[model samples]
Target chain A: MSLFKNDSDFKMDVLREVGNIGAGNAATALSTLLNKPVDMAVPTVSLLPFEAIAERVGGSEAVVIAIFLRVDGDAPGNMFFIINREPARRILQGLLGFDAAENDNYSELELSALSEIGNILAGSYLTSLADFTGLHMSPTVPSLAVDMAGAILSYGLLQFGTMGDDALLIDTTFLEGQQEAEGHFFLIPDPESFDKLFRALGVPL
Target chain B: MTEGTLIKVGMADLNIADGGAMLRTTGLGSCVGLTLYDPHLKLGGMAHIMLPSSDIAREGQLNIAKYADTAVPELLQRMISKGAVTGRLLAKMAGGAQMFAFMGGTDTMRIGPRNVEATKLALERFEIPLVSEDTGGNYGRTVELNSLTGVFSIRSVQHGVKEI
Candidate 1:
C-alpha cells in the first residue's frame, strides 16, 4: 500500500535533498539564535511503520518536547521539531537565560518560549523549501507539546493512516558540537501532497 | 499484584488476550484505544484505532485494525471465536485526545472526536454496552486492561494513573 511503490531511487534522492536544504536553513537559524555552532547530519528519508517512527526518537513512551506546525499551501504537510528533555533544557538555558527545573515540568513561560523557537525554525524551513521548489508553502501558527514521541508524532500520521499503516518521512537530526543529536526535524508530507511536491520540484509524478 | 503476561497493542494495530494476560497500548493521542472484555471468560481484546472509517481509504489493501468501523467488528469476531460471548461482552475505551489545539480547526484536527463517535456507533450496532470511557482531552494516554480483574487502568503524564 505504499504511495511510492512506483517511485524510483532518484525520487528518494530528491526528497533527501529537500530535507537537507530545509534543515540546513533551520540549523543556521538555530545557530544564530544560540550564538553557537549548530551542525546537522545528512537527512534520511524513510518509509516506515507508525510504530518505528517513535523508535527513532527513543521509544513509544519516551517523553519529548515537540513543536508542531501544519504546513499550508500547495505542498501541505506536517512538520515537527523534536528534542529530548536534556537538550530542551539546554536550549532554554542558552536562549532564554533561565535554568530549567531539574524535573520535567515546564512553566507556562518556558513552554511559550519553546513554542516560539519552534515557530522560527519551522518558518525558515518552509521558506527555504518554498524557494527551492518554487512552491507556495507556509506554516500555520506553531503549537508546543511535551509528551511521548509516539503520541505527538502520530498526529502527523493521521492523513497517512487512511492509506496505510506506514508513512514516508524526511528526517534530519541536528547535532550540537560533537555530542549526540540534540534535536530532529521530521517533515511528513501528506499522502496527497507527494504528487504535488514531486511535480513542483520538476519530478515526473 | 496479579502477575500476568502483558500483551502489547501497537499503533493502528489490535490483539486479544486471555489466561490472565493484560492487554496494553501506549502513547494514544487522537487515536482511540478501544477494548472489549468478557468478565465471564476473562478474555480481553484491544484495538488502537487511528481513523473513523475505511470508506475513504486510498490504499489497495485496507488494514482492518486501523479504522474504528472495521476494527470493532474484527476484534469482536476474534473474541467470539475464542469462546467469548458477544451478548455478555462489555466495552471500555480511552485516548482520543486532541493533543494540540489549533485556532481554526480542520477535519484533521477534529479526528479525536470523530474517532470516538465512530467507535460508539459501531459498538451500538453490535449491542455492546460501553460501560465507561475516559476521553476527549488535550493530552495523551497509555492504557492497560487487566484480563483477570477487568480493570482498565489509564496512565498519563498530567493526571497520573486511574482505573475504571
Candidate 2:
C-alpha cells in the first residue's frame, strides 16, 4: 500500500513545487556562503523501498558525510544534508580556505565546519517551507555522521517503518557552478504530518 | 544453482538458510541483524529486526520479522523446524548502532542500544548463549553467516572485516 494511492496528479505537483521552493531558498543561501553560483536540480519526489533510497546516493555501503536534524512542531519530519567526499573537500577548500586532505579521515574541525554548513542550509530550507505552508516547522540541533548512506538514510525511515516498507522522500540535488552535484537535501516528513501539510497548502488530501 | 548460495535478507525482513547456503543482511544501522546457528545441522536463521518490541506497533497487520521480541522466537522456531537442536544453537549479531549522536531523553534517539538490549533479553529468555557481537557504534555494518561453519562475518567502512 502507498501513501499517495488516492492522490491526484495535481497533489504530486504541489509536493514537487514544495520541494522546489525550499531547495531554491537553500541553494541561494549556499551560493552566498561559498560566494559561487550554486544550481539546484528539479526536486524528485518518490515513494521508495529502503534499499532503493540508499541507491539514490550510491549504494548501501557507500561512505558519505551527512548532517541530520529532526523537524519538530506542526509538521514534524526528518531532514538530512548529504554530501559526497570529493565535493565536501571542495566545499572545505572553497569556504574554509583549507587544503583538502589526502585521506578520508576528517579532523574534528573539518567535521564541525561541515556540520555548521549543513545547519545553515537546512535552516534556510525549512524557513522557506514554513513560510510557504504557513505551518510552524523548526529543525533541531544538527548532528553529523560519516558513515554508509544506507545506514544514515535508514534513520529517516524509522517512522515510516511502522506503516510499511516504503517511505516518501523529497530530494533536491545542489550543484556547484556547472560541475557535478555538491550536496543533497532530503526531506522525509512523518506519515501523519502529510495530512497537515496538504491541509495547510489548501490541497485536499 | 549451487547449494552454497548466498541468500539476502532485507531490512525488517528475515530468512533461514541451509544446505551450505550463506545468510546475509546489509546496511544495518540502529537495526540488529540477529542470527542463530546450529553447527550440528548446518542450519542458520537471520532476522533484520528494526524495532525493540511489537507491543507499540499500531500497524493493522504486524510484521513479525521487524521487531526484536517477535523476530527472535520466529527465527528460533524456523531453526527448530529445520531439524536444528535448540540446545546447541549459538547466537551472533551485529549492527545496532547509534548512527547520529543526539542529546536527549527521547526513546527514539536511543533505539539502537535499546534494540541491542531487547535482542539480548529475548535470547536470554530462550537460554541461548550470545557467543559474539559487534554493536553500539556510530557506523553501519553488513553481516554474513556461513551455514556450514557457523562463522559470522561483520564488515564496516570504518573497521574493515572481522569474523566472530
Docking class of 1: high
Alpha carbon lDDT of each predicted model: 0.92, 0.90
Model 2 agreement with the true structure over B25-92: per-residue lDDT tens digits = 88899999999999888888999999899887777778899999999999999888888887999999
Two-chain DockQ for each candidate model: 0.81, 0.70
Report the lDDT tens digits of candidate 1 across residue range B46-141: 999999999978877889999998999999999999999999999999988999999989999999999999999999999999999999998889
Number of the top TM-score candidate: 1
Residue pair clashes in candidate 2 = none
Structure candidate 1, residue pairs in collision: none
Give the residue spans of candidate 1 off by over 4 A.
Answer: A5-7, B1-3
Per-residue lDDT for A64-127 in model 1, tens only?
A: 8999999999989999999878988998898778788469878888899899999999999999
| Chain B structural similarity (TM-score) per candidate | 0.97, 0.97
- Top candidate on lDDT is 1
